[model samples]
Target: MMNITIKRIIIGICTTIILLTIYLLVPQVSNPSPSYETKLTHGTPVSDDIRAMLTPSIEPKRTRAIMVMQDGKVIYEYGPTDKIMNGHSTRKAMLSLLYGIAVDKKLINLDKTLSELDIDEYIPLTTQEKSATIRDLLMGKSSIYLPASGEHDNQITQRPKRESHKPGTYFFNNNFDANALGTIFIKETETSIGEFMEEYLAKPLGLQDFDSDNVIMGSPWFMPKKKTMHEQYYIYISTRDFARIGSMVANKGRWNGKQIISEDWIIKSTSSHSDLSNNHINYGRYDGFGYQWWTASDTNTIWTDGYGERFMIIDPDKRLTLVEQNFTGNSLLSSGLWLMNKNMDSGLSNLMKAHKTLAKNK
Candidate 1:
């Protein structure tokens, strides 16, 4: 009888284990993860006057989403804010945040040379490339001139010849610098960038949308050059979550009183490290480059612009963050670069107008 009871108990335990495994494997459709609170009580609604100013700049079908957060509350949002969209070069800013955290933890040394990291793939690095430091890459001054795939027309046209300028002296807006940095980050952290982001950033910030699965490796234009090593590689995240990133920057790397990243790193990464006045490619409104973010010539606002006019703008003085995602089609040519630039410029201008209007009404 005792032997029979033991067998029954074992069978019961095994069934329970199988049932638990199935339950965990199935997607949880009912109890979804928590996201940022609206907190509409804290801020005034976006006035109709401001909406009129913004609507002209944003095309409903072409523009995926736009979100505005002021003083830690959602003040305005338009379009499908919950939709996941690709963040092109804007992913560079996200990578910059990870670098800051790694630096703070002593996991990565900014002064480390590329040669020391043993980061070589597809094409071997030249001697000059090896000498570039991590800091140089962060500043977009890594004078390792190489033909980076999927680069903008301006970047390709303006790229300096190999060995023309010493590392840390010239700025080229080279995607190779950013891609190489991603490789180095992986070498130092022993974690994929996407996994690291999910564990350290997304979960901690209470972001509703972001996962390892959403992290795309390489651009289709550049195959065989390691996805993680593609500077043009992207992360697909919701506009609201993207705004949270800008909000963190505006708050000096703090989220809800917790220091997600060091305040010093935030200052250093957002401040103008390279003047772009003479850069061959005119970013139009932007005149300076920080670690990976862009800075306006006259304002404290720091921003990141993705291809096709996707942008995340952070204004520290005003304690405001805005994210706009315009994902229309595969080719950016559909919108044309000129129109894209104009759209971004107008969007930003109208956002400022909205802010002023809200403040005036209050």
Candidate 2:
């Protein structure tokens, strides 16, 4: 019996030693935190005030995440803001950023017509749709049409089918419409969309461990996974890095004193490129679309939207970046926008008040 007990003790000690060695060698904790040091006159007390502004007006059935960064400091964060979460179509914002970098590098000409490029095979649009330029698709004006046709239809109710249009006249979001962009990305860049995202946007932004692919079709994650649908139709990002990307956009795509993407491209991508004519189409409190980015003309806050309430809102005038993630439907996006507008309204008021107070003391 003593021999048996001794053997068990020895095994336990060996396991503990192995774990200790791994703890030391693996370097689990990241060192030298991501650079957030930048100068701004706003005092740090606003973090508390911002947190107070995040109380949702509605009963919280959905999971909500929020992060606010002002002047390079994380002023406030609420809810499950640390966990990795889906960023729905908000991924388009990063994709647009990648597109801009491609333009800046001369890899793509934003004005280049589809016919001149001879990459018509990828786009399933008819002749009219084929005439649509890269800018058209970026601005959400492509002839691509979704199955539901401007209604709140879930993915399960729809299987994306290609419409035989004249190829540049009308736009919809079908499989062909979404996948064609991926094909064109591969053809021109000689790299997959995932590769392009990494090489251009994510890597430079220090999101080296991110993952994204052109998922052909699947339901929103909140829905039960469908049969035979191997992949979902969006990019997943941790909420934290999602906020990091927003901060980068708010700073005009600069991180850690490095120009990850050109400032001019950032500006153009986030501004109002075109007016979405359809009154039925909801753009989450935005007045217009700008190269995959949504612009709130009223607040001058440009944002990228994802399905399931993922948002990366950048307020240039206030120098604030807000990111929010929610599992519920458009309510998160709508409410988050409402909450953001409230915070921006209140936060700026506080800062101005603080400035006035300082002025009086001086």
Candidate 3:
């Protein structure tokens, strides 16, 4: 009887192991999301003719990845979408997202003066600088031009003389505003940018790359002085994950059926606060500057740019989100004697043209 019992027990253990292995190996089907749309399914890319049309501009040697999503699904993709690349200046847009959430929760008021927030640089803020509001900073109108932490070498060289312009009057793309805003965001929300981003965005949006360990975080790369405060808040994100960010904004801050960010904030933040038509070549016909987001003259569209030729163009009118990144060299100046460090906008421009054609056909 003991031998029989031992054999049965061993068999039972084997059976349990086999069952557990089977469960682990099989793909589990998750319950459908409330706003699940059959049309939003992936794997079926756009037609061959369209791909051929896009290949020349998008699949060059230096190009890393290009993903164009229509109606929240990948319509065309070139290169590896899983690769995480340096975010550069595009990190400002992500900070703006955090600001939206904070503002929505009434934790930070846009109109609050810098003085009220106790924002001051080691160089000391002028009375006019202290009077600049958070909204002015977001809009790049905080005319308080001191030696800013993380201020770009070129931007520093171009920095308007200290206290030259008053707050909310001029629009200069300064790293100071972005960095200071980041510092303010952390202080007000009592959360690190990485934690807020991972919790508020990555996890909820089902991002494939960069979990808690590798989530987007800030680093002090552009700090010129040892005593300087705010760091250049950097975010390392993948192409596909950024497409999701674009899609989220394109939907006016809605993800699936849930309202991830308020539509009012999206509209307000994306609307052009500074007119950049005469300057900034990146903006289209009537495009201008918004709160960290570059506003297109075209209705219902926002453009986010990264230094060295990265871009995320979100067009709500066409239900499209396009992302391109990682240019090893400027193809435009590769053969030229002077290969300047200028950004190559050809890929994105070509993509925009293709998008317009596709939208018209649809």
Candidate 4:
């Protein structure tokens, strides 16, 4: 009995140490310390109808954070904009921004194929799959479709048979495309995503709540059971920081009297290169796809969204940006979805009402 107890204690200690080591290996970030409201400056106030949308929902159904900006000023905010959360697939849009800069610097060529870059996956890429170009990946038309690191069941199941369609011929959003793009970015720029993000975005934009701790050099994470050759470089940004990014995008990639990315790149990146109409998507939500951004089904507005309601919506014509973040405190799918979406629509509409600077022709 004594020997068994001793062994059990030793095993428990070893298990705890192993868990700690794994946790340390992967990057982790947290909410603000001494958490305070992220309301920096209030822009033009809105009417009561719009104010109602900015108000938080009841209890666990409420969102964690949201911010709206018009013409580089914060019009309103709800919850702690300083709160940090996984931007999830929204990182794809962020990568789009970086790619714009990289392309401007002649660091990468969109037409460059995976074959030319020598890109590969754990499951191995067929010669046909390797023919997909960086442009195809950005447009989510790779159609290479193999199980990737961040794939969920739906993604894996939705994948058409490999090589079912030629590169840039069909549109299918897959992790392999985004993850491989991350690898290609690192290889071409010879800079870690985190470092480049800091130098190009956070510092230049004067982001208040930017944190670099969760910036990993590889895929968002690694799993022993699931192996993938490409690593996903996830960007962890705050709601406020997201608004800055959206605003920059809305401003044609210009910030603070400086051209961060060429106007041409921004136009190309946000334009609907891939039309989703008549696609098999049952949801039938999005109308079109740009490099990484999604277009509103009814409006020309550009937006990017991630899991758990992390969203950044941009309307260059109106010069408006709206950002929201939630740590799954509640979901739009929950019973409260209608209410949340209603408020979101109202808030965004009011923000756009504040400034209607008609965008020039793209």
Candidate 5:
């Protein structure tokens, strides 16, 4: 009888161990962090009325996520809040913010020219291209006509010949300019841009979804010839974290009362530096170019939009920041381009409508 009892106890223990192992192996859906206030106690609650207004505007399959924050609190959220998505060109805005901090710390000089830094090791820059200053590149006025990788826009790839326009005179939203700026940023700061951002911006801003591992550095697929330049770089982050970055901009570089980035830099970077009204690449109405940020001519809003229907729009006047993420596909060169464009148009229209609705409700 004692022997039988021992066998039964062993069996029970083994079963318990197996069950515990199964429980441990199974994935658990964690509760949202307490830092993020999902409750609508802070600002105007995203009421049923608002949801009804915004729901019809969204294309469910095309838009992966949307997050809207008002007065530094999340007023609305949709889709998986934790979903990580490629930042695409919207990463340029983060780079711009880093440039602001770098400038504020006197680590970078805006007047620095390409020639002085010897930035043309791969394909020697012409005298005019070399004359393009860091400021000009930041302002999207760099006239350097080098073929840029990862750029799907026909306007830039089929643009005029090199040195057709003087540096700082004309504005073309070219990836070559942004890539060159990234190179310059690394050379001047004596550290990788991603490392700097992770240390300074991401940490201080409390970006829950950003990891330094997500920073991709290398050449874009289109430009195989430019091996030395490594022109294409991107950062993958969640829409919620993107909203946090936008909120920082909306609050004039202040996050939780701490001056994360200088307010002066924010003002300068978001201010209109180029007139993009006549440009064929339509970035909605009242579109203008700033320091890697898009400015609206009609409203006091600054935004960064990516190729794959991802956007972070900040309206300082309204104290609002909206971030949208839509994953079209791996490559913009594919048939996904049409869907991407459609998604972008629909998303922007809905966001604007929602903003108007919020204003009217308030």
Candidate 6:
């Protein structure tokens, strides 16, 4: 009788485990969300063959990815776009969009001097560095000079003497170049950069999943106590999700009939408002800079650049957009000449030609 009782208990436990496993493994089916059509302007046309033309070039690059959204529709998408790829200064452009939202909500005034706030408390530096304004930082002309290049290359050295280029005159991406600005946002809003970003931009834009996975609680690179920012590479976003961001910008910060960011800030941030005309940051592209965004040679072309050849290209004039994400290599260690760096030029050239053809047809 004792043996039988023990056997019964074991069988019961095993049966329960099997039941749970089946419940977990079996897929649950539910009503799918309603599909929505992309809004295309009447008579507007994008070349039907653009994706076909671009695909042949993509495979040879090995790690290349591409996605095109015409008038808010995923006309084409390919490769590891949903992968958590490293974003270098492309993040800087996204941060610029968030800054615009902060400005719209009166959290921080673009003209407000950084010295007026407790920016010094968060980032250690002299009054000169602290004197930089939000506008200066956005314009990439803040005199806050630091010796760093590319992503994760945070080697900052204060110039013994400030340069004569004058504030709001040059462009640099030193980590110290953006550090004080983050501190400025914190001081003005009584919150960290990441928190302010979520409250103002992500939530409104339906981007809760951005920092949901692989969160780094507080920033690992900066002063630890601030707890204002987090630094994790695993921002889980798909090509379409990223294209949605570009669409919002192309629509003047309006997302699905809602204003996610102020239209005025959108114009200022994407325009060629910088003094540095047609400057090349990576290799052989003469794109202009505005705030943190890059203005393409074409008046209507604007983009936010990311590391590993990731790009969110927006052309409002043509009512078209494209977002591509790939894991190429760190620019600093990129062996000087990688195929990925050249990918944009060839891709954009094809895209531009396609756009022109479509325009002519219309």
Best by lDDT: 5
Clash count, one per candidate: 0, 23, 0, 2, 0, 2
**Cand. 4 TM to true fold:** 0.81
TM-score of each: 0.79, 0.64, 0.77, 0.81, 0.80, 0.68
After superposition, candidate 5 runs with Cα above 4 Å error: 1-42, 56-59, 219-228, 278-283, 328-346, 360-362
What is the C-alpha lDDT profile of model 2 across 1-362, one tens digit per residue?
A: 99999999999999999876554343211212223322322235443433445645564555677666655556656676644454556655766777777778888875665666564542243656557677777765555553321123433243333444443434333333344444455567776666676556665666522544422234422344323211323555555667677777878878778888889988877887666565344444666777777777766677776555566667775557767676432223433455454422122333223323322332
Candidate 1 segments whose C-alpha is farther than 4 A from its true place: 1-42, 56-59, 219-232, 329-349, 352-362
Tens-place lDDT digits, model 4, residues 245-362: 8988889988777888789999999998877876666424578898988987465688888765566778888778877776532121331353355432223343334323322311
* lDDT of candidate 2 at residue 281, scale 0 to 100: 46
Q: Could you tell me which 10 consecutive residues in candidate 4 have the lowest summed lDDT? A: 353-362
- Residues 1-362 of candidate 1 have per-residue lDDT tens digits of 99999999999999999876664444211122445333222366566776676565535535567788876677778887766666778888999999998888899999988888776545677888888899999999988777675577777777778888899887788888877777788889998888888777887777776676656556433126533344545677778888887888888988877889999999999998887888766778788889988898565678898876687778887778877787533333432343554543326566666655654554
Where does the lowest 10-residue lDDT sum fall in candidate 1? Answer: 24-33
C-alpha lDDT (0 to 100) for residue 99 of candidate 2: 77
Which residue pairs of candidate 4 clash? 219-231, 219-232
The residue-by-residue lDDT of candidate 6 on 15-69, one tens digit each, is 9998766554432221112122232222233355765665654355545566666
Query: 178-248, model 3: which lDDT tens digit per residue?
Result: 88998898888898887887777776677766444443334322223536567666676777878887888
On a 0 to 1 TM-score scale, where does candidate 6 land against the true structure? 0.68
Candidate 5: Cα lDDT at 152: 73
Worst 10-residue lDDT window for candidate 6 reads 28-37
Over all chains combined, what TM-score does candidate 5 have? 0.80
- The number of clashing residue pairs in model 3 is 0
